[model samples]
Target: MATSVKSLSNKESKLIMAHMYVAFTALFVGATCGLLQTLERSGKFTLPAGIGYYQILTVHGVVLGLVLTTFFILGFMLAAQSKTTGGLNKTERTVAWIGFWLMLVGTLAAATMILLNEATVLFTFYAPLQAHVVFYLGLALVIVGTWFEGFVMFKRHARFRKENPGERTPLLSYMAVITMLMWQIASIGVAVTVLFQMVPWALGWVETIDVLLSRTLFWYFGHPLVYFWLLPAYMMWYAIMPKIIGGKIFSDSLARFTFILLLLFSIPVGFHHQLTEPGIDPFWKFIQVILTMVVVIPSMMTAFSMFATFEARGRELGAKGLFGWLKKMPWKDARFLAPFIGMLFFIPGGAGGIINASNQMNQVVHNTIWVTGHFHLTVASAVMLTFFGITYWLVPSITGRTFTKTMNKLGILQTILWTVGMLIMSTAMHWQGLLGGPRRSAYSEYVGNADTAAWGSYQIAQAVGGSILFLGMIVMIIIFVNLAFFAPKGKEEFPIAVVSNKAALPPKVFENWKLWIGVTLALILFAYTIPLIDIIQSAPPGAKGFKFW
Candidate 1:
């Protein structure tokens, strides 16, 4: 049940591929920095050229975590919407281009500041650890660019609905609109903090900054930011993977419901990231912690949905017994395997998230390298692998090229290397963190402290893992290039699975944007308004900015 689809026109393909170019380039540069950081942390290597470890760390975080993810998500979503809705109209395409240029310019400006050592602030850009004004401005531009892209998606979807009166909205377009909506809402917190708080302070317009307020606002965006990354991966799992595996979607209604759940829950739960911050009230933190826990529902729902999708599909292919269905899966198809492994990683990743959200458990791992390991599993592994999976087919589809069997084999090799690398690196990180290893610092002896000394072996293990992951990155970049430029010209299908006829049609109520957006806002205001007021009124003396680099 392939939903037969036409290839995107060259203009639209070019628009999307622009994002791919930036994204893969960022992957190369960011992974290099990551490898260097791991080696430096192992204490067997020293950074040359007077490069600060924090500078490279900042680049690693911002480039991979922010720039690469943001660019790829936008590009992919644009393709999704375009594919589902016939194609982007002239106006929509122009708007997307405008968005891309803004983001590219913003990335360049911020990267320059970082390379010059003027901005060592990490991706979170926590306040009082200020960077150059240009860096903050650059980030703002990037966010604004995404907003433009979001607008284009919304407009295109609206046009889709208007033309096709009673047709159920295409699943991919519906999901894209929801994802962008979540992003637009969640990003407002960071946008507010940057424009009003950090921007002024960085320009010396303010003498002191409300450290607690800045932090509170940041986590407001910070927690949802993780979902902003995860939802796209979920999109692939729900809508695209079934087609690749030659199966019908398990349940369309369930998939939409899961995404709506993420939108409602993802925004209000940011306080889970701030559980240890003293200025926030314990009661508010408790409330938000419960909200964070609610997020597990959708995550589990997704897991359940994937399981059902797989089992049903496998049984269709004549699989027998409980575990036999797993064997029926397409193991050699990198298109399926990469994202399938990503789903597997999220099982532990989601469990780790639950642990991080718990007050008692958070007390153990707060600010430790364990938190770093946690996200590496979720975003870097689960989300990234899925993106790579999407790229394998997507690049060729958009470029009017065929994905050769040779490249398919290469993609499988890439997935294996990435899975092995991440398992080794993330495990070492979690273990070292449990032993009291701190995150975000270079090699240190701490006067030959025993606990710190115990972390040495783990650091070395991390270096080895990072080296392997870098190799995986190289393989991925090679595949991307060959698919985009060197592959033989032909039409490649953009796979979108048909809904199972046994499943009930999705309810129109799910299309009620007003109800859901209103609920989301109400939840956020209820969770944040009181705690935010408390922080501002009881605020301590604001701290001036610091440039550690």
Candidate 2:
């Protein structure tokens, strides 16, 4: 009954599938790297001397964190756009394809350099650990491609607004546009760093790079990068999950407000990541810490809204009692179950985030495995699981195929494996971190060092967990391949939740993009401009690039 009223055109279907294909391929490569890294850290496995730990780590982070997430989000947004609004017009579709090709070429270029060991610089790409010129160039192209896609989406939204003057923009399209807009703004910092700073330095045009300045620029993009991955998951949680469970969004207005808050607060809090670094005033760090805490409010609001929606749906199903409502949900459906489990992980993930944001508390966990555990919960568990859940139905919707009932069962098992694996690995990471186990180290270096021996058991646990996670990923990839290419052809449902009765129509002001964007820019300027100026003026002499590995 929740099936899309209109089917996607052949062109739209092809565009969506193309993006998804790249994303899944990257996921496979990234997950394999992840398992390898975990085993290496546990001392159970070792790469040949030329293939170093940092090299594999860099590949894992870039492929999964950057390439996979970016490609998947673009594809998912396009699919959402087609289902919610009419599919993109011919010109828009052509633009999207161009962007996809650019991204693909860029990804391959970057991956090649990293694989060749020319760019051992980690995903953070912090200088004086410089990457090859092509690595920077390739990454720049990917960002430009995303910008093109963002522009097209913005244009489509504008046309929609012109056509439907007084109506609230369709929720999915509105959210998608906002996500892209926020990313465009957020990425400017990284873009500047790469184009003007890293590229020239890598090409020998500049002999040295200001390490602190480069790191500052990267963090400016890095913190919001989490939200870039997150907001889409939020989109599914707020707009799609409720419908999958036969309910409505608790409040459309609140959802929009939450996104607005994220856009405003997300950029200014990058300093929270750099609290331990010098060249920035403690005052500015304190300011960013407060801003980071402020950003958590919107997540809390999301939690309340999600629970309220679930409760309302339960009541409608004639369920009574507090716990009984949970049972009424469609847990059998992978589309609902996986994302809901993701939401559950977000509770802990968000808590860890708040802890990391605290200026005082951060010192204890800074650069430790604790931070790794925190992010794995957020991005790997919360955001990634939600993406997997989306594909359970989305791939079928685009391909006009049915994900077989057996495949659905396997999907559930895959989610369980991932959840259990992440819990085991992340828990060990956090505990070992608190005990002073450093992150980003080759465990072989600690062999026979009594100081680090306590970490061995935890590392072993991580390896076991990583192995299970790898299997889970393999299962997911197989399920999707079957759904896309081998499954029986049939129409699949595309769920879009309705606004709840308790929620009134959002005010026109909520749709005032100019106001929100202006406020976001103002907040960023207020928070970052002065600190950046201070950093520039007081920066130490730049350092020459190094390739220690």
Assess each prediction's global lDDT (C-alpha) against the native.
0.90, 0.87
lDDT of 2 at 226: 97
Can you write out model 2's per-residue Cα lDDT over 227-333, one digit (the tens) per residue?
Answer: 99999999999999998998999999999889888888888889999988977889988888898899889999999999989999999999899877898999888
RMSD of 2: 3.2
**Candidate 1 Cα misplacement greater than 4 A, ranges:** 1-6, 444-454, 541-549
Give the top-scoring candidate (TM-score).
Answer: 1
Cα lDDT for residue 538, model 1?
78
**Residue lDDT tens for model 1, 123-167:** 788866989999999999999999999999999999999999999
Report each candidate's C-alpha RMSD, comma-separated, in the order given: 3.3, 3.2
- Top-scoring candidate (lDDT): 1
Screening candidate 1 with a backbone cut-off below 3 angstroms (N, C-alpha, C), the clashing residue pairs are none
